[model samples]
Target: MWIIGFLLVLGPLVTLHELGHYLVGRFFGVKADAFSVGFGKELAGFTDKRGTRWKLSALPLGGYVQFAGDMNPASQPSEEWLALPEEEKRKTFPSKPLWQKALIVAAGPFTNFAIAVVILAAFSLAYGKIEIPPVIAAVSENSAAAEAGLQAGDRIVSVDGRPLNSFDELSDVVLPNPGGKLTLGVKRNGRDLNFDFTIPTIVERDRFGNEFRIGRLGVASGPGEVVPVGPFEAVGLATVKTVDIMKMMVNGIGQIITGRRPVDELGGPLKIAKFSGEQLSLGWREFVSFAALVSINLAFINLLPIPALDGGHLAFYAAEAIRRKPVGQRSQEWAFRTGMALLLTLMLFVTINDVISLPIFSS
Candidate 1:
């Protein structure tokens, strides 16, 4: 079931990502040699009229589309492609204009984001936005809220002068400033009241043993409203959600790099596969939601300006655009080799982290 779930999560998303590259390359008049799901030896395949071999491979982890000029699945161009006949050169990927190449490289990540947006939108239309009221259900005894004179049934209108949309909005004010004072504005019996209070810091460790400090107001939220959204509204909301997740991920990465968060918080394929199985056990909708999250992560990771990624290709294109020529082959080769080494190291570290986290292996 875990294997099935893993495939279900990665299969369509990877296919769509490759399809984006293939489509854009074709649109730019570059011939694609193969469109493959997974790497290595092929399991089954068929050739189309355009002579592209579409194959399902044994790995079933991720995929790539090889263009006519590509030396490998990594989309690196070769001297063979450069030395082609004049007519054949026109059909090769490297012969395309800078903008065309950029678009082709960018399309893979773009497709992943597009898939996420669609999935998120569909979920919004189905289940609607979770709208928990800002009202306080109960203030914890001797907690910050209680010390601030917060009462049960008090409706929070704002925190630090910022308007509150839901109870979760309080985290925006509190999480960043542990042990710092905050100004809370509440609506009690048709009257506005403001209180200044200090946040109590709490240390929390995630599944991967990463520790973080957060503040707790010690108040439970009231009941929530489920507001159904229209298709267009859902799409817009999904886009915002996508952007917000990306921002959070970026911040999280920065935090890890700065030693504010642990490096073990990073997850590789094993962690994701476990999550896929867990989500699948819950239900199809749960699995789909998980898949959407994974798709967004893939999109975000691929767009990092590291060599061997789509963003790396786009970066090369940008340099080419400015210098009126591509970066030298030797330079590109060294860049990709370094990138591959870094990527492998990251994967190995995260895989070890994942293994340590498993119940069978844990202390």
Candidate 2:
């Protein structure tokens, strides 16, 4: 059941991505011959009345769309495309204006962003949202919170005399102040305990190859245990949630490039499936949140300037617009081949990490 749900969830995201290309390509008068969800041997499919072949393949991992005159799966056009019959050449993707081609490539990632917004809205409306109080759950041994005399069950009323509402607020205040002291008004057993503690900074990693420095108090915070918001308040809260996640993702990527995070944590299909199964067991809300996070990730990834991806193609089109001539085919082909090799290598590495990181393997 978990596997089935995972497939259904990922399938639409992949299909929507391909649909973005299909829609934009057709709008630009380029013929798209096939839009397929998944790869490998075809499981089931039927040619549409419009002549586009819609297919479901054996692997439920990812999907693609084949444009008319595309010479390969990477969608590179051949010399034949340039020499085609005049009437038919009009339908080739290479014949589109640079701006239209750029838009066609950019559509996939933007669609992922749209998916995130919709999911976030639905989750906020349905669940009323959970928020944790600014209470300390546990302090790490010999850590900053413990050294500052913070203990379990201390209801943090304020920091520096400012009233605190939720755990999210507390984190925002603390995360940037690692190894720095902050005044805390804690309500204990019928008494207000005023104290000062320095929060420690620890490095953490997210889904992307990025690292972040987070304040460590060694406590767990959750929804409603701290503060809760209603429906209208929830939308603003949801938007903030989306924005915060995006910031963390950006920071993580920075850390990766700076050598602060290792590549081992970078995950691929196996990691996603593992996470999907785990979230499925947790129920609908958690699964929805997971999906939202992945959606944001997809959007960011597609924006990267790597050949064979939306971003890569957009870069080429941008250059064409500026220089008044497309990049030489040989140069584009070499770049694409390099990009493909790098991508496949990264995928394989991440999958290995996923397998090795399993608890069963640890024992």
Candidate 3:
């Protein structure tokens, strides 16, 4: 069941991502030879009106669109591509305008983001939003909130400069700023108070011995409510949710890079699968939310200026735009090779960490 769930989540994401590139490529008059969902030997397929071979492959892990004149599915150009007849050359990705190439490459990740936004909006409208109270019910002794002069019964009206209508919204802000002082606005009785205090980044361990570092405010939120939203309102809220999650991810990565958070907490495919299974067990709604988070992560990861990714291609394009010439093939190849090696090594490392945290391996 878990394996099935994992594949279900992976398939649509890959399809949507590749479709983005395919659609944009077609729009720019660049021909795509094949649209493949997964890799390896083709399991099933058909040719479309545009002569595009759409197929499903055995791997089931991911997919890609092979453009006309691409050396491989990775879109590397070849000698044959360069020596093509002038008419054919115009139909290949390499011969397109620089901006057109960038757009086609960038469309995949942006499409993933769009899918996430739509899913979130639909779900929000159906189930409504879970709204937490902004009122602080209690403040723990000697904690950040206590030291900041926060008291029980105080209402948290805002954090930093953002106004909050719910405690969950305020929590989203405070949770990512651990060990950093933040300006907080609270309403105590009839008077407003402002406090600045550093929140603690506490290391917490689960029953399975997996550890996580999270921000602790030492303040408890009051009860929560479910606010019904119309489709339009939910769409807007979904956009907000997407942005907030992106910020959280950026900050979390920065914390890890700066040595403020443990690198061991980083996860790989196995960890994500485990969580996906857990979410499935919780309910369909939870599972959908988990998928949305993954979609956002997909967008964020692809946008990083690393080689072999869309962003890497964009980086080369940026250089081309500035110098009025594309980067040398050898340099681009070496950079992509290096990036691929690093990404593979990191994936292996994180998978090992996931194994260590498994109950079967834990001492």
Candidate 4:
């Protein structure tokens, strides 16, 4: 189940991501030499008529597209690329215009985001939108809300001065701020009041025993109605959800960097496999939802301004645009090498962390 779930979730996502790059590159007349769904040794594949080797590799973690004149899968330009004939150079990625290159690189991450938005929109269409008011129905005894003087029947006006439209927005603010304090604006009996309190961090476990640390206000809102949504409205809502997920990802990474969140919270391929298996056990709906979340995560991670990533390529393009020339070849080579090293080190750390957190390793 674990292996199957891992493949089911990552296989399509990785393939689509690479396909985005391949399609965009082809659209720009750039020739791709290879399209791989995984890294390392090639397990199985075939060469297409266009000379592109479409293959499945041994490692199932991630994939890449190697374009013409590239040194390796990272898309570094080969030293001999400049010596290629004019016609050959025209079809290589390095010979493309800055905008075209950027678009080709950006397409991969954008495709992942699009996948997430589509999945979310489909869910919204099928199940309708949950619209719950911000009014507090109850506050738990001795909880953060209770200690902050919040009471039943109090309508939450805002959190930290941001106006609230629905109770669902509260989690958006709270979940990313474990142990952090916030000022709440509330209205009761036609009067306004403000209360400040610290959010409590709690460890939550799913039925499958997967654990998560999150902030809780210890307040409850009435069960909101699921209102049917039009196709357009569903798409709009899904876009908002996609953006919200991205915001949470930014917050989480910032917390980790600032020491607000533990480094161990970062998970890697193994952890994802575990989660995929667990979500698969719940049913297809839950599994699909998890897939959407993972898709957004892939998009988010790939769009970071780190070298050897899609965002890194875009960053170089931005610099090229400003400078009216590409960065020195030596500099790009060193930067990519550094980036690759950092990525590998981080992957190793997270994989070890994931292994240690597994049930077999738990004391």
Cα lDDT of model 4 by residue, 93-112, tens digit = 97888899899999999999
Better of 1 and 4 by lDDT: 4
What does candidate 2's lDDT look like per residue over 152-256, in tens digits?
Answer: 888889988999987777787677545556888889888999887666668886553335566666655544533355666766776677777778777666656
Model 1 misplacement above 4 A: 72-77, 142-144, 147-149, 153-162, 171-215
At residue 40, candidate 4 shows an lDDT of 92
Report clashes for each candidate as comma-separated counts.
0, 8, 0, 0
For model 1, how does the per-residue alpha-carbon lDDT over 1-363 read when each residue is reduced to its tens digit? 668888899887888898999999999898988998988899999999988999989888788888888775345567787678999889988777778888988999999999999999999999899788888998899888888789999989988898897886776567755666788899999999998877787788755443567778888887788999999999999998898778778867876787766687788878788778878988898899899899999999999888888888778778878999778888888889888898899889999998887768765
**How far does residue 168 in candidate 1 sit from its true spot (Å)?**
4.0
Please give the CA lDDT of all the candidate structures.
Answer: 0.84, 0.76, 0.84, 0.90
Lowest-scoring 10 consecutive residues by lDDT in candidate 4? 70-79
Alpha-carbon deviation at 224 in model 4, angstroms: 0.9
Best by lDDT: 4
In angstroms, the error of model 1 at 159 is 5.2
Instruction: Evaluate model 1: give its lDDT.
Output: 0.84
Q: What is the lDDT of residue 320 in candidate 3?
A: 87
Encode model 3's per-residue lDDT on 183-203: one tens digit a residue.
788888899888876778887
Clashing pairs in 4: none
Candidate 2 deviant stretches above 4 angstroms? 72-77, 128-214, 218-240, 256-259
In order of appearance, the predictions have TM-scores of: 0.87, 0.75, 0.91, 0.95
